[model samples]
Each structure stands twice: as C-alpha cells, then as structure tokens.
Target: MGSRTQDTEECYSYHNQNQNVDYGRMAEILVRRAGSTDEFTRLTSITWINEFVKLGGEQLVPYYADILGAVLPCISDEEEKIRVVARETNEELRAIKADPAEGFDIGAILSIAKRELNSEHEATRIEALHWFFTLLDRYCAEFLAYLNDIFDPLLNALSDPSDAVSFL
Candidate 1:
C-alpha cells in the first residue's frame, strides 16, 4: 500500500535466482530421478516434470503417467519443497491431459489423489485436497461420480484443526 512497503515486498520476492539446471535435457534424466531412492533427486525431478510435459506438447501423458505416479509419493516426502513441487507438477500433468489428443485413464489418476487425500501424513492430505479442489473446479462432472467415495476424506479434512486446511 505504501511505497516503502511495496519495495520491502519486492525485496522478499526472490531468495535465489542463480538456478542453471538444463531442465530441457533434464527430461531424459527425470524418469530415473523420479524413481530414485535419493530424496533430493526425486524432489528435483518435479521441475523436470514440467519441462518434459511442456516439451512433449499434447498427447504425451500416457508415456509419463507411470513416472509421475512414482513421484506422487514425494508429496508425502519429509522435505517441504519436494511436496510443493510434486503438487505443482501434478497440476501441470493434469493440464497437459486436460484435452488430450490421446486417451488417458482418469480413474487411475484420481485413485492416487484419493489415497493422498487419506495419507497418514498431514501435509500429504492437505496437498491432495489442494489438487482435489482444483480438479473438481475444472472438471466437476467427472469427479462427481466419486462423491460417495470421497465423502470420508472430505469429512476428515474438514475436521482437521489446521486452519489452512479447514479454510479450504
């Protein structure tokens, strides 16, 4: 609102910008990283997911869904950044498949989201809710079929004491 306040917000807008990973080429390496035992690599693979999806253009999902599923558990990873990017990448893949030129199974994708919604880890459940809400917003009719199945998770999420999760 004030000039000084605006400048302060801009200053905090970035903490690091020296990243130089060749994300384009990183696509080839990402499949392995997505399935890696090492946390960092699996986490870092999320960024590559976006790059690969973008580079693959339309109808590229069937090839990548398996790899993306492998990275899905990273949403429950201990490291916070990994959880964030795993969710972001999931959104990107969903978008890529939104109007796919090739058929992709919606049920398979939704199954993972359901499991994540009920994850023992709080953050994972929260992350799944974030995606579930977005997907419902974008494709409500498709997801409506699962309303019966999703009721328990939604009720559990509603009772969560975390203000952020409940506010959703």
Candidate 2:
C-alpha cells in the first residue's frame, strides 16, 4: 500500500511537471473521484480538486468553472476537509461571476447558483443566492431574461424549509 501510494504521488508530480497536460480532463477525473463514496478516494480527490482550483488564471477559469459545477451538489459532504473544499469552490464561483469572461457560460453559472440556493447549509446557500443577485444586478439587461426564468423557482425553493430561507 505504501508503494502504491508513492506511485500515485509520483504520477501526480509527473503530471504537474508537464505544464501542457489537458487540465480539463484531469479536473474531470478528480471531480468524479471527489464524488466517490470511498473515504480515501474522496479525501484524495478533494485535495486534488483544491489544488486544481488554486492554480487559477485565465487559462484555468474554465476548469475551475467545471469543478464548481461538479462539486456544488455535494452539500452533504460531512468531512470538515470536504466542507472546506466546498467553501473554496463557492468562493471561486463567486469570483468567476463577478468578472466573467466572454467564454463564460451563463447557464453553468446559473446552475451552480441554483444548487447553492438549495444547499443544506444556510450560510453557504444564502451567500450563493446573494452572489447570484449580485451577478444579476451587475449584468443587468444581459441576464434579465435568464433571471426572470429562474426567479420563480428560486423563490419557491427559498420558501421551503432551509436555514437559508430565513435570511432571504
């Protein structure tokens, strides 16, 4: 087991050294692993996920966006480490929403916002929804129609039982 773990670490190091590797694919696998039920796999994957997001820049924004979308649904992650990962993921999403690029996908952003609005954690959920509103206000007419379409669902969800609803 020690040798296997060392081998995995070496492979990860090798990939990190190869700057030209397909980060999107690598992130996708890590995201999948993070969702796994196995304790070791999930913890290891969360580490990779956090590392992947921390390598932020214009080139990595898309990958971070993908990671946010992939992990937002894991609101039930009990481990403190995984929760920290989720929080970091939320922060990254907010950053992306604040200054989205031409390549940014509004649909993907909305999906994550919607997921957050439904989160079990009140603070995280409310913050996510607030970020959504901030994004809407900033984008204005550009995002008006999309906001209109989602407003009803968001309102109804907010009405349902959740700590986030009280703050709404």
Candidate 3:
C-alpha cells in the first residue's frame, strides 16, 4: 500500500516530464475509479483528477465534457474532502474553453447532468443545476435540443425540500 502511494506520488512528480502519457485514458480510468463504492477510493480518484487538470491544463480540453460528467456526482459526495476537490476540479474544467468543433459529446454530459439533478443528495442536484448553467452559457445552440428534457427535472427541483437545490 505504501509502495503504491510512493509510486503515485513519483508519477505525479514527473507529470510534466511524461509527455507521452495518454492522459485521455488516464482521465477515463480515474473517472471510472471516481465512482467506486469505497469513499477512500473515490476521494483518491478525484484527487488524482484534480492533479491531472493542473498538469495537463489546455491539453485536456478534449476530455472536459466527459470529465465533467464524472465529477458532477462527486459534488455531493458524503465525504467533504471529496466534495471540495471535485468542485475545484469542476471549476478548472469549466474555465477551459474548448471548441464545439472539437467533437465534445455535450449530449453525454447533459444526460449525466440531468440524471444528477434527480439525485437524492441536495448537493448533487445543485451541482447539476450548475452544469445546466455552464452548458447553456457555453453551448446554447447545442443545448437547445435538450431544453425539453430538462423542464420536468427543473420543475421537480423547484420543489426540492432544500432551498439551495430549488433556488439554484
């Protein structure tokens, strides 16, 4: 276990030096790991994702939509540290400007965000709303087709017991 931790640290220490790394695959693996049932596993995955965003920066724009899909649920994780790190990662991904022509699967992200809006966790719902806002802000044209699908969930969220979820 300690060796694994040392190896992870060593790998991240040389993140910039390792230009040949297939970050897209790494992001996909980490995103899948982020969904683990174990809290420790989930937190570790998100932390590595945060580090990846920092190391890869604009180079990671192609994966932003998919990465956001994975991180959205972590916004409401039961673990506070996981929630914090996920939010930070989400923010970094959101700040990056990727061209729609780059073939981003906005539809996939919207599907994930819409599903997250229905999560029992209030934080998840709030984060989902934030996703809607961000998507609309950046891709209004692509988002238009999905407008119909969102109304029902948005209305349901309006009555959510949590004011934060409803108001946001």
Best by TM-score: 3
Go through the candidates in order and give each one's C-alpha lDDT.
Answer: 0.60, 0.63, 0.80
Residue 42 lDDT, candidate 2, scale 0-100: 70
* Alpha-carbon lDDT of model 1: 0.60
Question: Per-residue CA lDDT of candidate 1, range 23-93, in tens?
Answer: 32344456656666666566656655655566554435555445455556776777788777777766676
Largest lDDT belongs to which candidate?
A: 3
C-alpha lDDT of residue 118 in model 2: 63
| Model 1 clashes, total count | 0
Which is the winner by lDDT between candidate 2 and candidate 3?
Answer: 3
TM-score of each: 0.62, 0.74, 0.84
lDDT of model 3 at position 36? 81
User: For candidate 3, lDDT tens digit of each residue in 5-116?
Assistant: 6545654655656677667767776777788887887898899889888878766677776788779889888899999999999888777766767756677778888888
Candidate 2: give the clashing pairs. Answer: none
Show where candidate 1 strays beyond 4 Å.
Answer: 1-35, 63-68, 79-87
Q: What is the lDDT of residue 141 in candidate 3?
A: 91
Please give the distance, in angstroms, between residue 15's alpha carbon in candidate 2 and its true position after superposition. 5.0
List of clashing residue pairs for candidate 3: none
Candidate RMSDs in Å, in order, are 11.8, 3.7, 2.8
